[model samples]
Target: MPIKLADIAIFIITLAIIVFYSVTTLQKDSNSSYAKIEIDGNTFIYPLEKDLIKTFHGPIGDTTIEIKNGKISITESDCKNKICIKMGKIDKLGQAVACLPNKLLITIEGESNDEVDILSY
Candidate 1:
């Protein structure tokens, strides 16, 4: 049996799509592990070294933060506008989670023991 040119083209296109999807999915999964969450003056460190999901609730515009499957994101909120939810997921140290309506800010800080000294003249 002989393969038609159109059939070959279709097969190539399908393979390309599959490869693209697989690469994208893998990238997203790998990136999830580095997720972190910060709220108010306190920062929650999610090792993500193991599979874990954590949920946090605060008075920040009535918002809830959810960290699951190595990804940290805003799960729910009672604010009139869900702007924080649209901020999407954060997976880096020093990243922040904020709810403007409730005046809540969360920032991820590094675990370094270094101290800062200020000298006044």
Candidate 2:
């Protein structure tokens, strides 16, 4: 059996569509990772999409963490420097805010949900 020019063109178009679909699907990343707060070695996890405020007891005193509009930040900190609050808001995965004096570490934690898990340097 012999294939015509039109048939070959159709096959190439179909191949291109499949390749595009696969690449796009594999490249998709779920950016809904939760915000994690650590105080005195204790970890607390909250969804970044949820808006709320939480008070955590740190070394100095209570540290207030607020999540609004998919962003997380320290609104109040009892630590002398208040550096944690100064760190500002973060919603992306792997971002963090820390107050050493208060033993606090706030981070965005979750798998990237991408095509590859391990990257070699």
Candidate 3:
């Protein structure tokens, strides 16, 4: 079998794409951020810098969220699986924990004015 230049180019392109995605996914924002909670269709936004506890009631029951030391986590939930609670804490922008049965989602969001310098990517 003979190696072809076209095959080498395709492999290089694929490797570049994989590296790009991996770098983007592994990077976490260090700037100040916020936490967003979505229940049903309504969304509640909170600053991640604040320390507070919130409980949201849904058709199933209550879901407890706690934000402390710039980290947010689902401390309690009435859902049967308890997967949301197992998601642990999230402090970086774009991290999320969701409860499908209760239609609840908690996501980390950063300020829009945050500069996207070379280091950010």
Candidate 4:
């Protein structure tokens, strides 16, 4: 059997892509951290304090926002565009739940108080 140059190129490209994706995925997973949610000056420590999940909802230019679990996600909305729903679930620290039209912002705070030196700037 003879191997073509094109075949060798394709194999090399595929291997490079696989290696890149694997490294990126591992980095993301390893950096993930647990967080507590804070919305509108109220802290939602339900997941830590009560072992329960709570949901938040509001109008965002006709879209509704919903957050639950240890994560924030959009459950229902009326927006002509469903971009919020596509944003998916967020459970890590510094993650956010935002509804642009409704002026709602939910931020996740990590359990750790240690700060990265570069972040101080």
TM-score list, all predictions: 0.45, 0.67, 0.67, 0.43
Off by over 4 Å in 4: 1-69, 115-121
- The sequence of per-residue lDDT tens digits that candidate 3 reaches over residues 1-121 is 7989999999999999999999977776456688989997899999888999999997799999999998999999999999999999998666789888889999877764255333345
Best-to-worst order by lDDT is 3, 2, 1, 4
Candidate 4, run of 10 with poorest lDDT: 45-54
**Residue 25: error of model 3 in Å?**
30
1-121 per-residue lDDT for model 1 (tens digits): 7999999999999999999999987653422234444455565555544455444555644566666554466767777687878887665555666667645554434343122111111
lDDT of each: 0.58, 0.80, 0.86, 0.55
What is the C-alpha RMSD, rounded to one decimal, of candidate 4? 12.6
Lowest-scoring 10 consecutive residues by lDDT in candidate 3? 112-121
Pull out the clashing pairs in model 4.
63-78, 64-77
Off by over 4 Å in 2: 1-29, 113-121
Better of 2 and 4 by TM-score: 2
Q: Write the per-residue lDDT of candidate 4 for residues 1-121, one digit (tens) a residue.
A: 7999999999999999999999987653433344344445555443322223345544544434444544566655555566667777766556666655544555555544346322533
Clash-forming residue pairs, model 3: none
- Off-target runs (Cα >4 Å) in candidate 1 are 1-61, 112-121
lDDT of 1: 0.58
Using alpha carbons, what is the TM-score of model 3? 0.67
Q: Cα RMSD (Å) per model?
A: 12.5, 6.4, 14.3, 12.6
